[model samples]
Target: MKMKCILCAAGALAMCTATAFANPAKESEKTEFNRHWFMQLQGGASYTLGEGSFGKLVSPAAALSAGYQFSPVWGLRFGLSGWQSKGAWVSPENVYQYKYLQGNVEATLDLANLFGRFNPVRTVNPYLFAGVGVNGAFDNDEANALNDKGYTLGNIWSGSKAFVAGRLGAGVNFRLSDCVLLGVEVNTNMLSDKYNSKKAGNLDWQFNALAGLTFRFGKNHKKPQPAAVVAAPVQTTPPAEKPRTPAVQEAAPVAAEKPAVAEKPAPLREDIFFRIGSAQVRDAEKAKIAALAEYLKANPDANVEVTGYADAVTGSNAFNLKISRQRAESVAAALKAAGIAAGRIRVNGKGDTVQPFPGVEKNRVSICIAK
Candidate 1:
């Protein structure tokens, strides 16, 4: 039956091996496992419940385990645990001493990873574990010791040897660093009725509470990424200079023609529209602003007015007023960037009353006029 149980457990583990790494992948997540194989050393208190004295059942227990984590969620461990428990039955007459040892094959489950782990603040993982193993008794002082104490106990081995042990436990581990974990675990062990060399209706039990550190080892595998390549810059040659023309004799200067009358300043109005609900100016609209800047640069004395508005259909009065102000500020900022004198530009943030376009979309505009 022990062999059958072991085979069944092995089979179940094989089936779940693939599922260990089934966590959903994320793009921004950069954390990775540095090592896979790990060893743990733990020490804690152990207790036993059987046909022994009930008082002071506590004893010292310790274990050393080695394991490989298949993924963040699942893994396997093998360990040997030593337990020393001193107690007796409730009657206080049948006192028993126990020295127990066990070697186990345990399955580990990381509960945090199994559930959604999106919260950044939660870094600790609580886990569940179960295992089956061989149990043996080292101190066989059952019958002889009870007789020496003048207690006519039922015929039973005070110190027995060689039985099966099964255990289930829960623990919480805090990831101290990428390669280190600190945790505490409590396991309860179950065994055959004759485990303590005494006849009992139910299986005997042992409880272990341990604190440990897991030291990880192995080469870390990194997620694959494509390499980036840069192109070399192209070089160009300068154009050759043309030969100078022969100098010509200077001609007599003629009287300058009467100064031409200054032409009337022409008013240039440009309307730039933005996408609905967006304060960002598109690429196409940038060209228009650039052209206006160039024209103003050519005509130094020219002054400009920037009026911004939003469509009433798209936004509330207060929102439209705010957006309109943003639109004017954006256009004014652009003009200032073009080397235009700040004093020559007048910015006005008006209500959504200027619907110059055929569609409501057209009303979301900033109008610039240079005179």
Candidate 2:
């Protein structure tokens, strides 16, 4: 029966692995190995049920477990447990009490977040585990026949030594924080029948309910930043000088009418500039704002557009838009204070709709003027 159980467990594991590989959607999930390692401490009560030539015994036990999660989806646990129960045999006086101490190690696979249809916060995870280890037992004085019928008993009734054990369990994990997790689980350990010979060599079963806190370790758990893109520089060639025109020399030396003069185009100017989410202007920009005010005074015909922007970092499009508009209004107010006509200044906020730089901080704001 134990061999058959082992075979079935192996088959299930194979099927799970195959299914995981077959589904593309499952494969696309970011299995961030962030919580690769952890430790858990647990204490709980358990009921042991068993039957043998000696009798049947049901007992209560306590357990502690510590484990490491290989990923968000897989973990391995090692545990120690102890329990005591009562039993009866042929002779009415054959009643006795049994006690056991054991240890187990098992590998677990998370199923809830993996197989469940709905997961909002994505913090709750459930898993199933199965593995084999070892167990040791030491019977109580009564069961050891140390004082049988009020007299010293012989060694014919000693408890069995160490024996092989196997376990299967399920558990749930809740992420309480970035580095901490809370877990609750239930498991059953099957100790080989021969471990307690005095109890007719029947299989020993232990059930445990445990809760623990796990602490994750390592640098891989840190949040990742997006990669940056760099732009290549443009190349240009030098201009060649033109040969003197002979037609100009042959033409009558017309009075060199005052050399036709050319006027330089005006430099770009901003009506206003200020920070996002705040009305304060940056100190470095004060000189630029003064220069803009002087230029606007010289060219009264030019109209200014004070535009404001907010990055997508804040997470609310509507709120960002409102804030951006307020910022633009603030800048327009500043321009009005600088003597620019209310009618010559126009204000608008684009929020994140007109991002000039991809994932860059400098593209968050702007101010423009047109003639």
Candidate 3:
């Protein structure tokens, strides 16, 4: 049963190692591997498996680790740990208590980050590790007495007071913010037979579990935002007194005649855009739509012509044309909902036409022109 438990922890560590290298972040996030540093402090419980009372087998454990992360997915860490271990050795019924300290080096893999890097809302990750190091008991009267009784601190695993130990473990970390992480890990340590003041003649192991925080030190750069969409012009005239036919029917363009004195030309175009293949306007664009409705209310004779277009890159011409029409009608519906008279509104679809704008992003647009 003891051997079986050690083997299971080792297997889990190995499996996580394979998965971390095999999977990568999603395409959308473009997660990159970079260099960084971190410090961690953790405290938890230790349990020894042999001679002590099942009740007395519980002990305290704590560790301080420093790591260099080659990337979010890979890191190397070194740590010092101290703990109390009490258990029976040589037989299932014998119980003893001992204090030990160990220093180890480990390779850590963030398995969750490897598989879920593209998740924009990613906040949690599971990690795996394996390490090798040295362990020793306190150099006190109790330890010296054990050494005299052939209770060597180091047996085949060590020739001096210090002995070798190997560990395999798994952990989970939750990212609390940009530079702070909280994690919990459990490790199994394989030890020399005689180190616990007993001559078990067989390998013995213990388990330590710790929860802690990692302080990350690095900068993550941000991508640039796209340029704003420019609205296209439709009319040369300003607000005029003469009312033309409602734009729903064909309305002739009214040329601006300079009055005795001229002022700035009123805006002729109001554009509202949508995501590719979507007819829905975003929240930011709704106020612009409402403003157009307000303008129409102020100039009772004014009418609007709404034209919608779809980008050519994302969909087929037939599909683009269909969605473009839907987008135009959606804008016209919003206008009516904002209390503009339906009869004065004219809606048109211009699908997949080479856009007036520079890129595909700006091309997924709908323009509202005052007539």
What are the lDDT scores of the predictions, listed in order? 0.69, 0.58, 0.71
Mark the regions of model 2 whose C-alpha exceeds 4 Å error after superposition.
1-35, 51-64, 82-101, 117-120, 146-160, 218-228, 234-371
For each candidate, give its TM-score against the true structure.
Answer: 0.50, 0.48, 0.49
User: Tens digits of per-residue lDDT for model 1 on 249-317?
Assistant: 887555555554555456667788888877677888988888789889878888889888876555556
lDDT of 3 by residue, 284-308 (tens): 8999898898888877878899888
Residue pairs in collision within model 2? none
The residue ranges of model 1 lying beyond 4 angstroms of the native Cα positions read 1-28, 32-35, 51-55, 118-122, 147-155, 158-160, 218-371
Once fitted onto the true fold, the runs of candidate 3 whose alpha carbons sit more than 4 angstroms away are 1-31, 89-94, 118-121, 139-160, 220-371
* Residue 71, model 3: Cα distance from true site in angstroms: 2.4
Q: Candidate 2: deviation at residue 10, Å? A: 22
Report the alpha-carbon TM-score of model 3 versus the true structure: 0.49
Ranking by lDDT: 3, 1, 2
Task: Give lDDT: candidate 2, residue 99.
Answer: 68
Top model number, lDDT = 3
- Descending-TM-score candidate ranking: 1, 3, 2
lDDT of 2: 0.58
Q: Model 3 — which ten-residue stretch has the worst lDDT?
A: 219-228
